[model samples]
Target: MAPQLDPGDLVVRAQRGEPRAVARLISLVENAGPQLRDVAAALAPHTGRAQVVGLTGSPGVGKSTSTSALVGALRKQGKRVGVLAVDPSSPFSGGALLGDRVRMQEHATDDGVFIRSMATRGHLGGLAWSTPQALRVLDAAGCDVVLIETVGVGQSEIDVVSLADTTIVLLAPGMGDGVQAAKAGILEIADVFVVNKADRDGADQTVRDLKYMISLGDRRSPDGAAWTPPILKTVAARGEGVEDVVAAIDSHRDWIDRSGERDRRRLQRAESEIQAITLEQVRARLGDVGGSAALPELAKRVVAGELDPYRAADELIAAVGSG
Candidate 1:
């Protein structure tokens, strides 16, 4: 294995556009170990600099295209933007196609723009395992905006709310009953709703359906102010309505700052970090006690009806504690 990088040196080189350095730092963070604590400590001061925005939607909703357009618009305003696109890993191969990269080629050569594609790597939550570390790197590298594009897996995709300052859920026209999408819990977490492919037929119906759903959800701003998540129409392919999307993001940011919700979100994010760290430590200790070796036999016993899953877990815990 490559020796763990010196976090300071990695940050410096990444900011200078050294591809190898950036790749090494990302890999180290993604497959974090004890040394990651040191890296994260060193990176603390660099965080909170980037305005993190998350975009999510069902597959084929033009999330990548919309993100690309949003990045372009931000860059036009003289902002340095970083995009992290999360793609699903194949169950059998554990590899990701990272198709978002293809859609974001417009910014590939822009010095002010940086785009990275990350695999979910079987992480159940909305964020990739290394997301915090990657965000730290981007923040240190002087990005004014960081856009996270999630691998939208419907209701379970609420993880974005924890990872971003603003979360925009994307929708498209003429998708199966629009109500089906709303039922998937996508509406609950949205800071802003986007109706992409607005030029397509039934775009108005999609927007109307989403607004009606929002009304029923008892939506409010983080400060308990009566506010609805605005639904904006967009044609990301042709770059129409992108500016409005950008404006909506700005409006949310202003609201967060003035309403004190920003501080509340920061507190929530800190709590999330604590939980993630606790789980990681527990998992590592379990692995150290050869729990992986016992898993197969325990699973077989459960499948055979000789043991219940709850009992199997208790047994595993006992084995680890005794070992």
Candidate 2:
């Protein structure tokens, strides 16, 4: 077996580009043990240095292409970029295909850009459990901007909004309902919207629909500033409209800084980290008390109509709470 790694030692090795150490740190974050929590706490001050931008939309809407184009554009401007692509977990095997890297082959040889494909690993609240830690690693590794491409619009998609400083939602012109189907939480979270593949026939109509929907959401910034999310058209494959996207991102950054919402956003992210860590700690402790084993038995009993799930959960909580 590999020797057990001390958190500080792991951090040093990870900083030195040791792939094994980097992998181990990622595992620690995913597991979120007490030791890992301590590591995260220590690493917190080093985070928030990188701009985190989340790109999400319906599948096959060219999100990965857009991400590649954006990263390439940023690189041309001399900014180091990191791309984190979150792939959906397979329903049958619970493993991810992680094929986003294949779509972004242009960066395969670029030293200025780092790309990582992460599995959702059954995390329901939008990101993988280890995503925050992964972002911290990228930030410490000297990435000026980190682009997070989520699995797409679904129940967990809204989680990206809370993680990103500026969330961009992408849409293609010919999608069945166009912008009308995007009126829920997804539309509300976009700091900027991109009608990607503008070469398509209905691109103009799509942009108009998106603008109308955005108008329905609360436009006033929380800090009492006037900040309107702009809708940009893009043909990601041909590298069209990339400059506009970058400009919109810069504009949002400026708005955040000017309105003082940047500090508030940082505080909210810190609170989110605390909650995620606390829940992971509680779950870890529960695991030690046979809660994992007991849960399945209780679930079976409930399915058999021998016990109510609510009462069983109460009993389990009491048992673990006492232990």
lDDT, each prediction: 0.75, 0.74
lDDT of 1 by residue, 1-323 (tens): 77767888887787776756666666667667666777777667767878989888876788777888898899999999887777453111123335545555558778788777665555564253577678777877778998887755643345554578888888889985356566666666788989899999999999888877777788555668654688999999789999999999999998888888777887888787788777766676677654567877888899999999999989878876676
What's the lDDT of the predicted structure labeled candidate 1?
A: 0.75
lDDT, residue 9, model 1: 83
How many clashes (backbone N, Cα, C below 3 Å) per candidate? 0, 0
Error of 2 at 258 (Å): 1.4
Query: Please, what are the lDDT tens digits per residue for candidate 2 over residues 6-81?
Result: 8777777656555566567666666656677667755565666788899888766777778888998999899988
Residue pairs in steric clash, candidate 1? Answer: none
Error of 1 at 73 (Å): 0.7
As a whole number from 0 to 100, the lDDT of residue 173 in candidate 2 is: 91
- Least accurate 10 contiguous residues by lDDT in model 2: 89-98
Q: Pick by TM-score: which candidate is best?
A: 1
- TM-scores for all candidates: the values are 0.81, 0.79
